[model samples]
Target: MPRLNAVLETALYVADMPRARAFFEEALGLSPFTADHRFTAYTVGPSVLLLFLEGETTETVILPGQMGTIPPHDGSGRVHMAFAIDAADLAGWEQTLDAHGTSIEGRTHWPKGGESLYFRDPDGHLLELATPGVWPNY
Candidate 1:
């Protein structure tokens, strides 16, 4: 059986590349490590946040014998993802989001003892800043 370790990257679809880039870079403080006409990738701790143009992502195709490409995926509707943060940093994160003019959609205290701040990105993808206890294992 193959075992999975950690999530090294996560992809989010956006309608506007420039707007998404600005939200992740200027607003969220994530530095873009690479970008092209259709996508931008930002390093988030050990993982990468990949933002791709909606239609472009759906049209991606990989040719095995030739040049490989990311498998085509749909980029419609609101998608959700969470980033883990230190428990003590929750307050600061809220302040940061406020300063960025991003409204908090909700806040939840998980039954497992974790806490989360829910918000949306420029493209309306639901994003969360959560604590380690959000899952069974951090």
Candidate 2:
């Protein structure tokens, strides 16, 4: 039997569709490979990042306020997603974010060996731009 092996897409919940679209399209240098009012999809390298708005059409959870406050919605709780980039590109990536006026949550350096910068999308879902060394054993 052939194995089911493709990682085609990953979807994220967002409070505002347009704002999410703008952040990915403008800030992250990703264009909407597909889009509509309910969902917008962007090309993130070999995979696609999709934004699904919260509402009747979709059952996405909008954290009430801030990190660690939202009650669990789908049984499994507390999740975060990250985008990995080349370690050498960190400074240039920071420049892109700064130029786009994206809000920076903070940056972290792993004593072992790695770096990451955290930020949120329009809907406040935590996102990180990380280096592979952050999880060297994985």
Candidate 3:
């Protein structure tokens, strides 16, 4: 096997694109790197978080300059995405979420000494902010 470096992108399909975009922008303070009527992409640290309107990506998308084609993709139900944060930053993050009116839906104290704060986006996708030690590598 060659190797795997990192996850480049993650997508979440939403019933309302504007609402979803706003939630991420306001709650997480993420600004979109690129966007169009079909979708909006926010640079989440090194990776990208794409918010695609439900049913909009049912057909393959052809990129300009013959770069490549993105195959049709869609998702439903509650899905989860976790972001890594420092232990010292956890409290600030919770405060930020509260200021944005985003509630902390749940939390978990991992056996590895990590802590996670769980919540939902406008689309109801479960989002997590996890501190290091949550994983062996981290």
Give all TM-scores, in the order shown.
Answer: 0.89, 0.73, 0.94
Q: Write the per-residue lDDT of candidate 1 for residues 56-116, one digit (tens) a residue.
A: 8666576588787866776678999999999999999899999999999999999888999
> Considering every candidate listed, which one attains the maximal TM-score?
3
At residue 134, what lDDT does model 1 achieve?
A: 86
Candidate 2 segments exceeding 4 Å error? 1-8, 59-79
lDDT of each residue in 1-138, candidate 2, tens digit only: 989765777768777677778888889888777777777878777788877666524353464556434233321123467888889999998999989987778899987578899987767678899886788551
TM-score for predicted model 3 compared with the true structure? 0.94
Q: Please, what are the lDDT tens digits per residue for candidate 3 over residues 1-138?
A: 999998999988899888888888888989998999979998888899898888899998998996999899888888999998999999999999999999999999999999999999987889999998788887
Show model 3 residue runs off by greater than 4 Å.
none
- Ranked by lDDT, top first: 3, 1, 2
lDDT of 3: 0.91
Superposed Cα RMSD, model 3? 1.1
7, model 3: CA deviation in Å?
1.0
Candidate 1 Cα misplacement greater than 4 A, ranges: 60-67
Clashing pairs counted in every model = 0, 0, 0
Error of 2 at 37 (Å): 1.7
Estimate every model's Cα lDDT from 0 to 1: 0.89, 0.74, 0.91
